[model samples]
Target: MRSLLSRRFRATRAVTAATAVLALASVTGQVAHADTPAVPEFDDGFGLSQVTEDREVHSSTDFSITVTTPEVAGQHKIRIFLPSDYASEPGKRWPVTYFLHGGPGNPDEAGTVEALRSDQMITVAPDGGRKGWYADWLMQDTAEGAANWETFHLEQVVPLIDANLRTIPDRGQRAVVGLSMGGFGSMHYAQTRPDLFGHVASMSGGIDFGNYAVRGAVVATELNLTTAWCAVSSSRGCADYGPVVDSDAIFGSPYPVFNADHIWRSVNPAASANLAKLADTGITLYTGDNDLVENHTADGVDIVTSRLDKLGIPSRAVNYGDGSSLSPTCNGGHNYGCWAPAFADYIPRLEAAFAAEETK
Candidate 1:
């Protein structure tokens, strides 16, 4: 497998350029149809048939749900894969893994499909609201843009998936994983609400918002004029959408600071003291050494892991072998390619986490 770093760098460069163009056009009042599919829909063994209770279970049919939250409204097209024995053992609850997507996009990539199959766990990939940070942002036009993804995941998606599918609703049986932005979201959500998830993983995730703010600003500048960048300040009319308070607090500040600390403290998990709370739960952190893009950095993971260590929190961090930067492939990088295989490797560990929760 190509190292996570190489994949992240390549993917980030591609996404950055693409996002810049989109943001510039949007800011210029160039409204485009939002109905276009963000990613191509394809099956990677997720739709295969299975046998249960001596009966064949067809995988052609999967659930597609639309979860509308106050902050943001979007669809969660899910592919529910029951274990081979699920049909035979009716009413048995199984662990669920909420897989997330990178950037402001869909999780229908090839690698993601493969991960769903290899994990054989009930996988849920909801569209992570507008801007794709999976968090509320400062831009008002994108006000509804900042989907309360955290709330949606815990309150809406989890319960709905559990109720509608054959999933173990207990917190212990639940987990989340993602790559790039999705990776950041997984760890952020897990750290913020440890009571809800047992195991969390990120593959070449962009976990540090402090770093992202600078990169995002740079990308915004490159994509559009300075006026477009300035417009982001007013959420109501701004075309460039992103977190509002980052640049003011981190990069420049002349007068005595008020609330700047709190603003900075809130978004960066590395700055939060509550991160230790996740230790009582469990965390699986992984990134590639060469991932030196906007958010995918060894330094980012190192920052979080170091904090966890300080709090005596038990966690696992892995760095894949060395390789040049590559886009997420079917087999490697932060995209579905690498995520699918990694998911397979983590299945037993996730099952054990669920089992441990059961005993408790």
Candidate 2:
């Protein structure tokens, strides 16, 4: 009888040891905090086979995915932030937010990634082509084919996310937000593809792409390398112009709205023609009052908001701070510092818009 009791006791201790180890694992597996969801690295929604991921270039919450599309040159890299439960709950669907980075920036910027690290939504940042302006380039070539950044995002990236990830996959569940060049991109994409995104916000966005002065300044500053090949050796009659200024790649040359042949009229958000299209969608614009580039940033917001008002379309435009919106606290000055706060403030409003649409 004593021997029998010892065997039972030993079994109980073994079970207890296993249980304790499991409890510790459960605690450590939580991604952020105890309450945070623990997503799996691979699931029906995402896996190593569907979109190739770079493990080396990742944060605690973010990772990179690469895919090749017919629209642009070579393979494109998209940085994605999956919520904690992303892998843990395979049956759940989440809203998606396409975050466009500013000009001269790419998907790997830590500051931008940090801004979105804790977001519960599935956040995606595409390769903005550095200075691709998120538009289809005129005829830039890659080994695969002509570079079409716009088509890649609209046609390829969105669908891939929907197919591979457990996304809501509806117009009302998606939002687009951007800063600087990305702001222009968000506006362009939202207006062009109203069926894709429900809420659109631009923080110090290049909204008024048709503004000649602004476009000129942007082209000079961003694409400053003057190439003689553009002016002297163009069989297509394309001059050595700033990508937006004279090249047919963007708005088709001759700068801002020529009365006779305004090629850019339809796409120019600042113009009455394009602003009219955003009437039904949730629209918001923000800029720092002290932004030196207010002529293009805050002023663009003012111009577009005024046009929307005239058209009887509801929109919100805010110019924050009275002095140079430069912050000693944040990076400030038309950069990620200002952009981070703008995003924090804007996201709640965007979520409210989504909720309102669901009720409707």
Candidate 3:
């Protein structure tokens, strides 16, 4: 039964073909928290094996880029797969999808490779920032913490990939997906830069950062801001732990607005006015039944769905019966172990969407 399900998860040719086309055309491209190990190192020639004739896998230890953000310096390594037809048919363009790793600290090389093997699509994962929420600073002084992340991604990373790799060059061919912090990043990127990605997906994402902060799931010290605004606006002096601020002065009036705005902009699909843009671009949302962060996931889905409905934008959401958030399998939890399968299941749908767009 498990094997059968796995087979079902594999990418179909229709999807593979579309992905290949988008990837080829996208010359455009495009994180951290830590104390955790730096992104993992892989063998230079590592690649995925095709589960089917239509799929092919490729991995490169050299598939990496480094960005020196104003606040932090980091390296991003990526693993990619090109469909069997990609090399054979040199003239084609393929759509691209980025997979984001959870934990902000975890590296996504292996699972990314696995998903590529089954899907025969272009995929990449970059390490998230050192334990930060990938936000823009609320205040200029706190730019290092979260604000720089946006610059690192939009300026440093995307341009590097487009210059270095054989990929689709336009935003219409690109998509983003991730788990936990990565999931939040995926949605946040799509909202912030609708012109850069065609679709976005979040799996058990930490989508409600405002709620999390309010609940104290996020430590005050980890936040670097005089108020959160300062953190959002500037990378310097952003860590609450690094420097003491007069909270009495900074916390009350405008800081909360920045916090609310940040959250509202990041996951509140309605706030970005991008739902119509997503409908035009083919965005998708998904989560598991047993995602560890059930409340956030549910809220994300509900909010996006409600917004999309009001805007009359067509979208799809999936909830696997498996409740475990760590494993991708039926018993896996919210981590990669659980998301890999969800990714596998979604690849075909993604491909089909791409294919449909191409024909039109």
TM-scores, in order shown? 0.65, 0.74, 0.63
What stretches of model 3 exceed 4 Å from their correct place? 1-62, 65-72, 84-90, 109-113, 118-120, 139-147, 209-277, 289-292, 321-328
Q: Model 3 misses residue 66 by how many Å? A: 4.3
Indicate the TM-score of model 2.
Answer: 0.74
Winner on lDDT (2 vs 3): 2
Q: How many residue pairs clash in each candidate?
A: 15, 9, 68
Residues 187-231, model 3: lDDT tens digits: 778777777787787776655544544223233324433343222
Q: Show model 1 residue runs off by greater than 4 Å.
A: 1-62, 67-70, 74-76, 110-113, 118-120, 143-146, 212-258, 294-296, 323-334
Q: Give residue 331's lDDT in candidate 3 (0 to 100).
A: 48
The candidate maximizing TM-score is: 2
How would you encode candidate 1's per-residue C-alpha lDDT over 1-360 as one tens digit per residue? 235686575456445544553332433355323232122122112112112112211242233433334545433444345555654565676788887765434544422355365334566676663244655443334324434556666666666666546777666788888766677778778877787787888766666655655345433432333443232211133344334433332222222267544543565656547576686666886665632242345667788788888888877876653422232442222334445555666667777777778878
> Model 2, 263-327: lDDT tens per residue?
45656778887777777778889887553454457778988998899999998887875423534
Ordered by TM-score, highest first, the candidates read 2, 1, 3
Superposed on all Cα atoms, the candidates' RMSDs to the truth, in angstroms, are 15.4, 11.2, 13.8
> If both were scored by lDDT, which would come out higher, candidate 1 or candidate 2?
2
